[model samples]
Target: MYYNTNILKSTDGESICYYRWQANPDVPFKGIVQIAHGLGEHAGRYNHIAHLLQEEGYSVYANDHRAHGKTAEIKRLFGYYDGKEYFDDCIADMYALTNLMRAENPNSKFILFGHSMGSLLSRKYVIKYGKELDALILSGTASFIKVLGTIGLVTASTVKTFKGRERGNAFLKDFFFGEFNKKFKPNRTKLDWISTDEAQVDLFEKDPYRTEDFSLGVFLDIIKNSKKVNSPEAFKATPKELPILMFSGDKDPVGEMGKGVTRVAKQYEKYGISDFTFKLYKGGRHEMLNEINAEAVEQEIISWLNQRI
Candidate 1:
């Protein structure tokens, strides 16, 4: 069964909206999995995945991050102000929800599954609270911000210098679609999964909960946090024995740069962190969970969790 509710996080004064899929509530659960979605998307998009997990005898919970989906915030589609605040709020909110879930199911193990930007935040949370989780899965992850930070810094400075000036969405278009400019026209509608699914693309464009733009300040904040997470200090903070699963698509742009998912694993290996597994999907894209053969991906995830947890 599916249930939706909101929990007021006293820690940050933000009401976190979430969904819970109860699978075999009577029988003791093997574990609980919390999902964190990528940018421009909301937790509701994972309804199908939640159902699948439920069928697999696992309770699933997902929350829409602040400034995204039904969460309260300014600048509708774009997040303004401190990006670290966003990350902090997300961690606090996740912790709060985990506590609540644990209270209800005391015997179940806890695991976290994060995608894209969410994967970045998951790593930060793990470094701080690694002992609390049994396992972690990072999908479509990379070690760097991919120039979004540089563009955000410039735009943030411009906004600060010229108060009351509004910048166009040209930066977003350029940063996300600049490479495909010659091959295909830059239409905001085609920004789903970097694939050819017109129907899915249309759904994404029409989704009211989806955010397409972010404030210069918020973008810069994310850049700063991203850098911190990739730093040697943060890498060292993570326990060497914590089991981590990292996966990404070979064709995804995150894998295009020298800072691909494998690069992330290699960095950790350099620090003697060997309790991890990294996989690359041959032709998958950024949103592997939403791809054509999502079952294959889901099965892979379940198999990993079964072995580790």
Candidate 2:
């Protein structure tokens, strides 16, 4: 399956560069998979996953979120949200893309796949627009720690007050990701915590788009939204009927070594989302999709989707 790169106008008139992988023309269309990538990465990183889904008769679409990937390149606003409504704006842009996909395949099931920070955005999305999706897949997701989130938000805000929102705060960046690589003692690189696969980490380090330092404002936005998604009210607002699959590595620091991921699962159960599934890969790190056992992880995802659709 091949993909086409196109631009879509977001709700606020931001130009969102997206990729669309149409399912095999000869095969019956199965469904639609909209991918939301993690922070500091582009939608293009998931092209292989899109190909797999397209081959399985599912059309795939992924957009470069604001201040990331091609969209950031086009706007020249790398790592800058440019406004206070950063998180909401990203969700709106996602909804815009969702509407486009639904318009093209009105009868097909729609699945939203989000990884890491994207997973947080997707969680927020379900609260407002859960009915718009047939299912949800969250990768490298976690339940937010309220106390730490509050401190991070305050710290980021203070930094932005002293410096500028557009200036990248190396201290804030370290504060967020510094501890992630600690588990992997004598780490080969700073991003070894992302995946056990050294090659993937190398590729990430080499990719210019992935190397962009996030601004303090971006950190603040992420912390604020992370808290929102983890709130009990947000859980109650989620559509209980929507099927959700949450998967992560046991060693993923973002998931707090799997404890946070488990907490999220329990929250879903408490909120009456009976059709929720949680999977933890032993010894796996943050980015299971790029890990050594990535093929197995991909197969597991496909198997789950097949059962659902």
Candidate 3:
């Protein structure tokens, strides 16, 4: 599989860049897999996953959000996006790109896969654009408690008054994710929460596009959107028939040892979602796709997609 990079002009005047990977033309494609990557990472990181999906006759697409990855590196939109509705712009970007690609490949279904922060955004995406997709897959995701979200609002609002949005701040990252590496006390790298695979962690560390920090505004937007997704109202508008797979690591701190991930899945059920399932990978961490047993994780997801799509 080959990754073809392209830039599309967004409705909001910003240019969005994406990677499109098509399956072998000799075989009929099953559908389109459009991925929304997590924060501090780029779309290019999913190339390996794209190739795997392509082998199964699925054309995969992953886009860099406004201020991350190749889009940010080339356009210089790192650490911050252009507007206050940072989260809104991200969903809009996905909506635009998904429609464009779906138009070109109208014969097959569309499966939206989101990881980590991308997973949080996908929760919003499925609710708003549920009718547009055939299936949804969420990885490395969690349900955010309202109180924690409120704290984020207060902290970010106070921090912005003093530090502003244009500049990067390490305060939130240290405070929120600082404990991730504590479990792996003898770990060689700070991003040990990502994966036990040292090679993958090293690649992530060396990547220039993967910035280690984010702006206060960006963090607040994440917390707010996360709260929105976990709330009961988020899924009221979603189509019950939309097949969703919510999978996370049992040991992932982000998901609170699978408790919040389960709540997220249960919240969807409470709101009338009827065609979804949740799973936890034993010994898995935050980045299940990049974990030591990543191949098994990828195979399992592919199986699930085949069953639904």
Top TM-score model: 2
Worst ten in a row by lDDT for model 1:
72-81
lDDT for model 1: 0.71
Candidates 1 and 2: which is better by TM-score?
2
Arranged by lDDT, best first: 2, 3, 1
| Residues 233-301, model 1: lDDT tens digits | 888888787778888776676545224577788888887766788887776666677666677888888
lDDT of 3: 0.83
Worst lDDT window (10 residues) for model 3?
Answer: 145-154
Per-candidate total of colliding backbone pairs:
1, 0, 0
TM-scores for every predicted model? 0.85, 0.96, 0.94
Q: After superposition, how far is residue 286 of candidate 3 from its true place, in Å?
A: 0.8
* Better candidate by lDDT, 1 or 2: 2
